[model samples]
Target chain A: MEEEAETESITLQDSAAGGRIDGKWGYIWGAYSVTWVLLVGYTLSLVLRGRLLRRSSGVER
Target chain B: MKLPFAWEHLIGVIALLLFCYGQVFGLFMVPPDAHMGDVARILFVHVPSAWNAFFVFTIAFVCALGYLISGRKGFDHALEAALEVGILLTILLLMTGSIFAKPTWDVWWKWEPRLTSSAIMLMTYVGVVVLRSVVQDNERRAVWSSAATILASVTLPLTYFSVQIWRSIHQIQTSPADIDAPLRMAWRINALAVLLLATWFLARRWRIAARRWELGDAPPLPEPLQPEEV
Candidate 1:
């Protein structure tokens, strides 16, 4: 009986997650991921550029 | 690890923490809109990016005026940093706006006044940078770019009021009554986070410009094509 109850609970949890499966979640996830990825990527580029400039110019400060 | 410290890095860390808080709150805690549902959550980022883009451009405009008046490199460096950051934020605004539009508007892009004016505003600043690259003299580059920035800034206002001035499919600004208190809080938190991030960006970029000028390592210009001997 406990095994049957566990299976039922698992099924219920899957249905609760159905919102993510809908197409709308893809848009939401894509927007958020892209925003962060681009922002972080630009930050990294600035860091790299600064280092490159420092090294190339031989300014070891 | 004893990391060598800079105050700007501290600002960055704080901004990062706030960003995570705001992102989680908007993504998970906030309730979905009645009509737009989960898609409305995107405005938490998009609206802030738009506001901050306008903010930086305003600073850039003021810096341009300062440089013209004072003939100071300080103003010029600030102007350069602001333009680069304003470009980044505007790009973010447009990209996220398009992302939000795909689900809600059923199109990745639309030719509405708000969207069209925004693209022009972005191109205007980018053009200043491109023009700066072409001019060989440092003083000429600074003066011309400042003049260009001052003139181009008019587009910023045009972009801001495009929806109100003309018939646009894009929705105008929403009032407090339009959303719940929690939604307002999420938006404000994200706005602050983005503002700090932009400040850090401006400071870092300004330092780089100053360093380049100090090192006499400004970017090399292409030599004008030599006339072939007849």
Candidate 2:
């Protein structure tokens, strides 16, 4: 089992070492970009929601 | 053009700073992985989101129980807040997982146990939200939503353990100690930042719930630490 696992990891390393996987920067960029945009958008929405709530309720904290 | 940052908002500012630092470090300072190269960096955010989503959902589960037991509006508000933030993180987690998967797993999605369980988790919380919206009566809404939240939360542990139970293709839960030095540092920093960020979001959401209650949508919260029956 350990030998099989080691062999699999070696194959993974070979794939990563080769230029075949070099272009995976797209996936990395996509993941991080989505994270930032969604988080920022959510935060903005919360701020907007808070502003509206304060305006409608007339009580600011 | 900005309001003064209050003491309560300090955690959020700090969280944002830490997030910036963590992301930069993860993206540039860390070495590429031997197995997945730079693509492994996605785990810096994806892992944190996944863990924190579970943490926030666990909070909601506790709040649900608190509401069911005490009939306190505060608990109800907290439950609502936690669920909102939890759902947000879950979306972030799943979406990033997809983005990461396409390259590594060679598919945007698979009906793997982990992914399937996460879908169940998301829909259950959404159902709780729908339950809240349809019930007009405050008491009924609170009780019904609280009940639904508790039931929905059962899926939390299921999703959390899905990888382990089913031997999923999804990565198993890992401890920082088990990781290499640089990767562990990035992971730890990002995880803390995400926790603080989620806390800030939950606080803001809870405030919104309170303002909503004050606007006569639901009953007002009882005195702090004095959770009266709803």
Candidate 3:
């Protein structure tokens, strides 16, 4: 039973290493890039709209 | 014309810097998950975005109730701003979740209970925004949107607990006790950063809505540029 458990652990580690070798970095990068773009873009849109509204209302801050 | 720096500007700058710091720490300093490998880093942003989405929805729900009770236009403006930010955060949550799913679940999308409920919530709020636009009278718009917001918020709690309540491929919600110390730290930091950023955005949006409300229906248009003098 102990030997069997050892082999199973080894197999798990091997598969994990294989996943790293396969390089799924693209997925990670994609997720981060998309998040950054969406957040920054939305914030910029809000800022611009605020400026436009202020200009239109002629409310000098 | 250069605008003077204000407290909101300071808050915005601090929020941006803190978020960047959190991202760097999360991506590089925290150890990768044994099962998920480096891809687990996505949790830094994804979880926080989901939390903020829920938070903003709760704000919208409260504002909706406030409007009903007080009949104040300010509450309506606050409701609309919160709803708008909540929608944006929900979209971010969905997109990030999809991206994370592709690697971890080996599928880009799934029609599981959590995903389905979240999508429904997103659509319901989106419908509220559209409903507000379609209605012409201010009182009618406020009444309709406030009612819709309250109705839509029912899905928020459902979506939050879907994974636990139903059979779902999505992982159960993580708590500080469940995560490693370093990961917990990074997650908490990022959560705070996102919350600050959301607060800044919410403040600006609420102010803009209030200003428009004050301006009434006919806001003056910009004057056309005159021809240069010969």
Task: Enumerate residue pairs that collide in model 1.
Answer: none
Candidate 3 segments exceeding 4 Å error = A1-22, A59-61, B1-5, B219-230
Candidate 3 residues B40-134, lDDT tens each?
A: 89889999999999999999999999998999998999898999999998998899889888866667888999999999999999999999877
Per residue, candidate 2 scores C-alpha lDDT tens digits across B1-230 of: 66686554999999999999999999999998656778889999999998899999999989988988998899988988998999999999999999887887778998999999998999899899888877876667788988898899889889988977886466667666767999999998999999999999999999988778666653233233445743
Q: How accurately is candidate 1 docked according to DockQ?
A: 0.15
Reference-based TM-score of each model: 0.85, 0.87, 0.86
Candidate 1: where is the Cα deviation over 4 Å?
Answer: A1-23, A59-61, B1-4, B217-230
State the iRMSD of every prediction, in order shown: 10.2, 5.5, 5.3
Every model's DockQ: 0.15, 0.42, 0.31
By TM-score, the candidates rank as 2, 3, 1
Q: Give the higher-DockQ candidate: 1 or 3.
A: 3
Candidate topping lDDT: 2
The list of candidate 2 runs beyond 4 A from truth reads A1-20, A59-61, B1-6, B218-230
Q: lDDT per residue, candidate 1, B61-110, as tens digits?
A: 99999999999988888898999999999999999999888776668999
| Count of residue pairs whose backbone atoms collide, per candidate | 0, 0, 0
Error (Å) of candidate 3 at residue B211 is 1.5
Inter-residue clash pairs, candidate 3? none
lDDT of each: 0.84, 0.85, 0.84
Tens digit per residue, CA lDDT, model 3, A1-61: 7975575556445434445423477877888899889888988988888888879887433
